[model samples]
Target: MNKDQVKGVGEQIKGKVNETVGKATNNPGKELKGDLQQAAGKVQKAYGDAKEAAKDNAKHKAP
Candidate 1:
């Protein structure tokens, strides 16, 4: 996986932990922040996925 993919996954895991902790602690703010972090991580992971797909397509199309 690329840097973005790895980082994204890491962020997602961290976000999930934060969200769970926030929920257990009854902290809405932390929960919201965790949700945002997860969203950002998803976007980053998608971008990395697209990049890898494009690279593969280009390689396959090459002579």
Candidate 2:
């Protein structure tokens, strides 16, 4: 996958770890941060997906 996709997945994994740790430790702040990180990662991954789709579409349309 592209850099964005890789980084996004990485961020999502980290967010999950943080969220789990937050719950285990009873830290609302950490939990919220983790939630935000997951959201950001989702957006980044979506963007990367769109980029890849565009590239594929372009290649298909090219002579």
Candidate 3:
């Protein structure tokens, strides 16, 4: 996977941890922050996926 995909997955994992911890500790702010991080990660991963798809398309289309 590209750096963006890898980083996005990492961020998602980290966010999951934070979200779990926040729930355990009853911190709404932390939980919200984790939710945001997860959304960001998802976006990054999607972008990376699109990038790879475009790269592959270009390679296949080349003469």
Candidate 4:
């Protein structure tokens, strides 16, 4: 996995924790921040996936 993939996964987990904590404590700001972080993580993860696919394709095409 690329750095983005790893970091994205980590951020997703952290976001989940923050979201839960925010909901439990009734903190809207934390909840919003968590939501944003989760979205960012998803994007980063997707980017990493695409990058890996491209790399794999390139390797396979090499003679």
lDDT of 3 by residue, 1-63 (tens): 799999898888888888988999999988988898899999999999999999999999999
Runs in model 4 deviating more than 4 A are: none
Count of clashing residue pairs in every prediction: 0, 0, 0, 0
For model 3, what is the error of residue 27's alpha carbon versus the real structure, in angstroms, after optimal superposition?
Answer: 0.5
- Using Cα atoms with residue i matched to residue i, what is each candidate's TM-score against the true structure? 0.96, 0.97, 0.96, 0.94
Pairs with backbone N, CA or C atoms under 3 Å apart (clashes), candidate 2 = none
Query: What is the C-alpha lDDT profile of model 1 across 18-42, one tens digit per residue?
Result: 8998999999989988998899999
lDDT of 2 by residue, 1-63 (tens): 789998898899989888989999999999988998898999999999999999999999999
Deviation (Å) of 55 in candidate 1:
0.6
Model 1 alpha-carbon drift over 4 Å, by segment:
none
Strongest candidate by TM-score: 2
Q: List residue ranges in candidate 2 displaced over 4 A.
A: none
Candidate 3: list runs displaced more than 4 Å.
none
Residue 40 local lDDT, model 2? 91
Better of 2 and 3 by lDDT: 2
Backbone clash pairs for candidate 3 read none
Expressed as tens digits, the lDDT of each residue in 1-63 for candidate 4 is 899899888888888888888999999999988888898888889889999999999999999
Q: What is the lDDT of residue 37 in candidate 3?
A: 87
